[model samples]
Target: MRIGLYPGTFDPVTHGHLDIIRRSCALVDRLVIGVAINRSKGPMFSLEERVAMLEPICAQMSQDTGCQVIVHPFENLLIQCAADVGASIIVRGLRAVADFEYEYQMVGMNRALDDSIETVFLMAEARHQAIASKLVKEIARLGGDVSKFVTPEIEAKLKDKLASS
Candidate 1:
């Protein structure tokens, strides 16, 4: 089966992420959403919280698309995480030219490490192109509406998280 890995911090999975996840189902039989445990970034949500949030959404996507979708949390190198998940393709969502510059370097480094695994870039839909998790969190923290960037469920979670924090 063709398995693909899409790695991200997913502090709070945004609509942009869902867009990529939905589209990625067409390219692979199994899509593994790799939730990275990068402490350096100091994510708003815990690793477990992030995984919890993605599970239900992924399950729904799998059911809808007939493609197996699973969330895997990883603290190791992204390339190593891909191998662990048996992914031959690493799917990445591109929002703009700025994202490409960073992703380009990552693709090159990943290729140098494992030439067998290929990286595929999917452009975010125009509407979602501007929706980023960081921006979503920022807007939420400042008491702004984030309904446009996240699902209603996620929006509630964000509000709850912010209220508690």
Candidate 2:
């Protein structure tokens, strides 16, 4: 089976992330959503919360897409995580030139680390090209409407989390 790894902080999964997930599912036999432990970025949700939020959504997506989706948490090296999960390919979404530059460098590094691992880049759909989780959180924190960017469940959770903080 062609196993692909889609790794991200997913502080809160946005439509953009889901778009990539949807596209990646069609390309690989099995897709694993690797949630990174990135405390340095100061995510809006805890690691546990992020994983919890993704589980049900991934499960439903797997049912809908017929692509087995698994959410797993990882720390430190991403290349190691991919190896651990037996992922032969790393799937990434590119939104713009900035994304391309960054991801291009990472792809090179990942190749150096694991010669057998290949990287695939999927361009974000036009509607979601500008939607990023960081920006979504920022907009939501300032009371801006993010209903269009994230799911209702995530929107509610983001609003509540921001309101309490």
Prediction 1 global C-alpha lDDT: 0.97
Off by over 4 Å in 2: none
Tens-place lDDT per residue, model 2, 1-165, is: 999999999989999999999999999989999999888888889999999999999999999999999999999698999999999999999999999999989988988899899999999999999999989988987789999999999999998898788
Query: Which numbered prediction scores highest in lDDT against the true structure?
Result: 1
RMSD of 1: 0.4
Give the least accurate 10-residue stretch of model 1, judged by summed lDDT.
156-165
What's the distance in Å from true for residue 125, model 2?
0.3
Please identify model 1 stretches exceeding 4 Å from their true place: none
TM-score of 2: 0.98
Alpha-carbon TM-score of each model against the true structure: 0.99, 0.98
